[model samples]
Target: MTTRTFTNRLTRALRERALSLVDTGRPEGLVFLGAAAGTEIAKATGFGPLEKVCKPVIAPSALVVALRDGELGAVDTALLSATGAAYTVGDVILMLGGGHASRSVARLASGAAAFGVGHVALGALMLRSGIRPKALQMSFHGAVAGTVGGMLLREDRGNWPLATYGGMLAALSALATSVDHGRAPSASVLAVGGPVFLLSDGLILARRKVAGGSLAARALDVGVIDTYATATLLLLTGTAAAARSARGR
Candidate 1:
């Protein structure tokens, strides 16, 4: 590559790093992986069939369901009334594991997998019928993600939610693979990494703020904080996970 072109790409990569402060710890890798994943899906199943397989099944919240039933109104929204944002995204995720939403997601994933198998079987038939390449590309990706998602959802680990996020991230990474290049890490890494990075950064940011010293001093504080924080969080989360698993057995 020309020097100018190499410089431009390097510049973009640096910009991506800065942007990642608000994004995932793994962004380029995530987007490229999702997009590239979308591409493989395209190859296996056409876009239309794939969409049908992977559409978010409505696992609406109680408030949302109440709204649908006309029992609640926009003025009474809990999210709007809450004092903390903690209940926002975090709760929405946990809620999926709670009630009908869990069953609904599981059922939808299962249906998608079944339909995907049929699509793959018939993809063979359509090759002779001479379907367009673009359509085939989309179909393949849809089938892969849908099928893979359904299988992963059955994991007994507390990873159903993480798996959903992972599959979507992977599919998205696949979609944008042309821009970012790497062997995509599995969703499980990301599932844990999200909290790992957040807790690590939060502890550092907190110590830096509280240490009330110059940058170099604060940098030293960071080393101390990370050492303690990571050990503690890993111990707690790992212990909890182990207990849950033992209970299951």
Candidate 2:
């Protein structure tokens, strides 16, 4: 065969292989696609503009989840998504009301606290339903990392409150992770969702510490992380509900 023909064949083979890897129904493929889409969306909207659009984009994911899970399954799923929406709105408020830094911080802190509460509630529900998570070590480590990162990124005037909220969020996330261990469909969802949630928060904090005009800072500050985090959370809750429903049948 000619060299050009051989090269073309090789390229096509490689492309097909890559596409196959990414097109699977597995959790890994979902994560890969989610992250890639998130990155592109972040770039397109720009950080500030993205926040304004986040709530609308995320609401539909929750609705689809509710529909798939059914009325009984929708309860927890709806609660989870509602709390997430509240948090997103709070974040947007903080971003828009930039002139009132202290008030904005307070609003953000309140939202974080609410989100943390939701995590704790979800963990409790999982435990009540007899799901025993096997990843305490992972959860603990995540909590520690979140605490340190929160402290490092604490705002100047609102340091104490913001750090406290950050620590709370981290702790709640760890609890949720621990509760997600042995569950079926939801377990897989949380496996990826939990870490991405942490990444989203960490990036938000990091952006606050960096220069606003820089590319890294803009990326960090974008709604993409929040969008991805919320979407994964919906997936986690929805899958868990679906799993329970399937088992009940």
Candidate 3:
């Protein structure tokens, strides 16, 4: 081919590649924004220290990159899991301030609200992923159930706003269970994470309800941290696998 023709082809190819990046990058950008908004809002409400504000942002952003490029493996998965664990640990550390007794209801309520915003972002991601209308409806149902559960829970009983937060988290977890991860070989793996996520949050809510000094209550307390850490690790690993599958296609 002539030099002019080759130059024209090269330019066209580059333009197309750039456009493709923009297309995929849109959802990834939303993911990052969601994470950042969650982290910053949670920080503003004193959910955790300011120094840890980037925890939420970093975890989701890294997952986005992994999804886009399909760069993930055992070590990468470990790091992602570690990041999630650290993020949860930050909240755990807050209890050391004075335990639940030291935390005000308003602060707790605000933290839950901040997390609701994050869940909204997660919903957007779900829609972008092509979740069916029926599945979406079921997610709302999960929210309702969770809201009722939250309202009934002893410690947070009658706290409509906090119940709403529980609803949001429940919705996301439910949605995760029903989402079509496409033909990604790890679709089953992705489904597993959702239930674990639900379990983690359930433990948190249960812990609040049962403030006894009993062994079961203590187990619930510790389980909150353990399950949360495990949930994050599993969810991110599944995400990575799905990403890899997509990239291969």
Candidate 4:
């Protein structure tokens, strides 16, 4: 398809997907147990988190392929640090600030850190495999990272967004390099976007779970939205980026 057509389709698809995720978040709100407590939760809340979590999401592999057509991201941006340190780089280190710092990365070094780091790692993988962040890749990468981060980290601890997202972006920069062809993506993005995405996902789903009256049953409610919404956001971002790229092309 022509770039314009692809852009139009992607735009429409994203709008639709956004609506879908929003809609999916609703049923829980209607019967929300917090309003009535436990009894209301069992009988009233129809959509359990599991039901929300199980829904399938479309993967935008093509956008990643387009990114490969350009150049390696590392040439212009570096994913790794100079002396094998993760936080030394300008961008990565900057994540220490309070703003988005909640999405901090933890490794053998960070210890007991959030898994959002994995999503960032995957971002590098996709880029290296020649996957462009155009629109789909970026959004999906970010969303997944955010979802995973929320799941793993819960100390209410905050870290640097730069190190986390910065690392992922560095990976995207490296992907532009193409050291290996089509390497399977790492789950790092799940680690990076965790804090941000979780906050958003929980805000949307948690209310419903509480209202549905079964806080325990819906404890994973935010996860339900994260499972699909995060992936969709990544695809949408990639699609939008692709659209912009096509314009330049």
Best by TM-score: 2
* Per-model CA lDDT versus the true structure: 0.31, 0.49, 0.50, 0.33
Question: Residue 103's C-alpha lDDT in candidate 4?
Answer: 34
User: Candidate 1: TM-score?
Assistant: 0.21
Sorting all predicted structures by lDDT, with the top scorer first, yields 3, 2, 4, 1
lDDT of 2 by residue, 1-249 (tens): 554654454355335423533555433444434544554465445544544444334433443333343444555555545554654455455545541122356665765665555556555545544545457645675667666655656535455666665565555455444533334433334433555666666666555556555766556645445544454444345345534744565
Badly placed stretches (over 4 Å) of model 3 are 1-69, 72-103, 136-150, 153-158, 212-214, 240-249
Model 1: CA > 4 A from native? 1-8, 12-161, 180-249
TM of each candidate vs. truth: 0.21, 0.61, 0.53, 0.28
Candidate 1 residue-wise lDDT at 46: 33
Answer with 1 or 3, whichever has the higher lDDT: 3
For model 3, what is the alpha-carbon lDDT of residue 32?
A: 47
Question: Model 3 — which ten-residue stretch has the worst lDDT?
Answer: 94-103
Worst 10 residues of 1 by lDDT: 180-189
| Candidate 2 worst ten-residue window by lDDT | 179-188
Model 4: CA > 4 A from native: 1-6, 12-114, 131-249
